[model samples]
Target: MKLRETLEAQEFEPYIHITRGPGDGGHWARQYAHRFDLVLISGGDGTICEVINGLSGTDKPIAIFPSGTENLFAREMGVLPDCDQLIQTLKWGRRVVMDMGQVNHRKFLLLSGVGFDAHVLLELNKFRTGNITHLTYFWPIWRTLWEYRFPPMTVEADGEIIVENARGLMFVSNISRYAVGLRICEQARYDDGLLDICFYHCTHQFRLVKHAWNTVMRTHCRDSMVTYRQAKKIRVTSTEPIPFETDGDPVGNLPAEFSVIPQAVRVILPP
Candidate 1:
């Protein structure tokens, strides 16, 4: 059945807004949120991130209807692509409040990456012309691995320094799992009022490979080189131009401060 038909069956008046370009989803969502009781995002992770940013500072409940984009947040929220499930969720789903992470001035609902993965996303965004599939990541990851030099950075969580001038990838995540199902921040909890930070102390290609293997095996927490912590606020800085990404999109270079907005976003989930 069509979305409009399904919504009408549930006594909802559907309002469809097709995003014209980047940031349009957030712009429109912010502009019109006062008029709607709930907002449904029918796109992938990027689109969902945009809409979530738009809906910040409001009590509006948002629902994720997975489209062609990688719905990593949806995965964490137990949202699926089934039409009947989506429609039923539109009406009778449980309302759960999830934490939102803010880095610099931008808000992210799922995960954020600093260093290596951000470098990979930066390269991917450079050549990204259209919708990308999982296969589209091959060239970017390979190119970034060879080209990216491990930039040194320091991390301060809740005003205490955890890793000082570390060289590797740092993940500040609201969700546990990452790309290819790697539980990069396995201790993350969306409603926990804190952000989980995981750092893989990688200095060479061999160590990077080893860290990846450990992350896949869910044994990185046991490795001494891997650092894991959770806090309400985090400050990451680098004198060098180190990049960072939030919710799979490359945002900007660090000297960024991250903080958690607990019980911020109200999302509908399968009951």
Candidate 2:
């Protein structure tokens, strides 16, 4: 109510809805889909993902107010935490259309991952609580590294076939940022109309440590053990069922196809 009051004091009319849960906002937003000019999401990544799924086919522009843990997508776009500045940005910012990734007809605002990252998400989901933070992801990530086994998989992207017999994480992204300010896909651009694929193909602990170091230094993609490619479509299939996650929410297991919808959704951005 305070945020709404602040916006109203500035003479901007904002539609506010208090949803029952994570998935409820999406459905509620869809109910008012055609009436609102802009959908301003004021929750976490999971809430934004639900809104994205709800507004998938429409041309409505979205402005995010980051109120959730691990606001990777919002931080990448340079969205700050000040409500007054956010209101001003909304009033005067330029509109840009960006690509969204689709998995089995669901929409994801940021990257999607299969195998290792998904397992981490599952662990986090079980352990996470109010105001999830970097440590929430970090602890599980370390645990997953210690106990998790990487499964072999086949990935086909942009006509290049990779059949790997090792365990690691595969990240498919339309944006550059990941958790804790990591630039996992440095070459990725929001409006580039391409999907960036990063595969960690090494199974050894020491090599994985090296990969982590390179990732922190933003040089992982250049390694021989790390495969990076740009494709319009990517098909990932594993020998067994592997969990998959999109935008920090666990969806389901794969055999999955992820395709880019270029310039698909309109977003209000800082001018």
Candidate 3:
């Protein structure tokens, strides 16, 4: 509401949109983006993901309000929560063109997970009621941690076999930072026309926990069980369809092929 007042005070008549359910943000954005100069989004990572999908392949730049839990992309772009900062960003912000990742046909601007983390979201949605916070994930994480099986999978990067029949977690990211500031893809550059994929080879629950700790310490790359690579295209296949989370939503199961779209979107960034 304060954001609305601020825009109104500045003599801008912005159309207000409130999403009613899943994919509404993207639906509205894709349908009405042609009429707008700048698309401003208010919500969390999931909402931002939807908006990005709607505006994919267009020149319409976006500014975020960063109201959601773990607003990872907003933090990566240096967007803040204050209305004053938002006003400054609007008036004198840096304009950046960023790369986006595509899984199948859907687009993502942050990171995608293809293993246990994605499994957590799949379980969370089974009982998700409404808006979620960091705490909302605790139960789901705990449950998925116990139930998840380290499925065997094969990964190909630019048509080269990087991982063959590996059992662990796979992360593909456009940015370095993830939830809780972990640099899962530490060398990722949003404009570099490549996606950074990290595979943590684990066979048991204890190994999974160790991998998580090493990742948080930013030392996972040096671990023998970890594989990190940057590629223009990445493909992962499993004996069974495994669920993958894009941005923060558990969209569907995978046999996913991920490709990077260079300079695919224009974004307003804090200076």
Best by lDDT: 3
Query: Pairing residues by index, what is the TM-score of model 3?
Result: 0.96
Local error of candidate 1 at residue 185 (angstroms): 0.5
Model 2: lDDT to the true structure: 0.83
Q: Residues 1-271, candidate 2, lDDT per residue (tens digit)?
A: 7789888888878778887876798898677877987888888778887887788778888988888867877887888667876777788987889998888887787999888889888988886776677666788888888877677788888666865555677899988988777888878888899989889986756677888899998888888888888988888888788899988878899888888989888888776
lDDT for model 1: 0.89
TM accuracy, model 2? 0.94
User: Across residues 1-271, which tens digit of lDDT does each residue of candidate 1 receive?
Assistant: 4777877887778888889988899999889977988898888888888888888888999988888556778888889888799877876899999999999978898989999988898888888988899988999999988888888899999999999998888999999979888889998999999999998888888889899888888999999999899999999999899989998888899898999999988999877
Error of 3 at 240 (Å): 2.6
lDDT of 3: 0.89
Assess each prediction's global lDDT (C-alpha) against the native: 0.89, 0.83, 0.89
| TM per prediction | 0.96, 0.94, 0.96
> Is 2 or 3 the stronger prediction by TM-score?
3
Better of 2 and 3 by lDDT: 3
- Give model 2 RMSD, 1 decimal: 1.7
lDDT of 1 at 160: 96
